[model samples]
Target: MFVAAALALLATMILTIVRALSGPTLYDRLLAANSFGTKIVLFIAVYGFLAGRPDFLDIALVYTLINFVGTVAVLKFYEYDDSVGGDYQEDDY
Candidate 1:
């Protein structure tokens, strides 16, 4: 049953990948990536549980935080890029 759940998650993950790949706009792609990141974190937790690796959950939680931060950063960067016409007008950091 655990493996069955994993397979279902994998199927949904594939759909998310397709959404990310074919997104028509930056926001759409960002959303898809964010969703994928969230799913990945869950997948890690479930798989780790099934494999009896309790410690792996700590790493998964850490990566979940990273994924959230990364998604925000990517969205902010894209917004800045769009607003500035892809020019380096703002602070260079």
Candidate 2:
């Protein structure tokens, strides 16, 4: 069962990578990237369980946090056009 799940997750991860590469807009690509990250976490957990390595779950959890933070940071950068902690001009509109 776990093997099947890992295989399915791998397939979906491939599809997600394709979407991220060919997405029409920035948001689409970002969403695909986020989805890929989530699938990776699942794959890690599944693989760890199948292999009887409990430590992979810890790695997966850490990756999950990183994914969430990275997505948020990217969105912030897009919104502000500045990720370097520099000042941003206020839109006159």
* Winner by TM-score: 2
Query: Compared with the true structure, what per-residue lDDT tens digits does model 1 show for residues 7-57?
Result: 887888998899999976555677888889888888888898778776688
Clashing pairs in 2: none
Taking the candidates one at a time, how many backbone clashes does each contain?
0, 0
lDDT of 2 by residue, 1-93 (tens): 999999999999999999999987676788999999999999999999889886779899999999999999998887786554333335522
Per-model TM values vs. the true structure: 0.80, 0.83
Q: CA shift at 68, candidate 1, in angstroms? A: 0.9
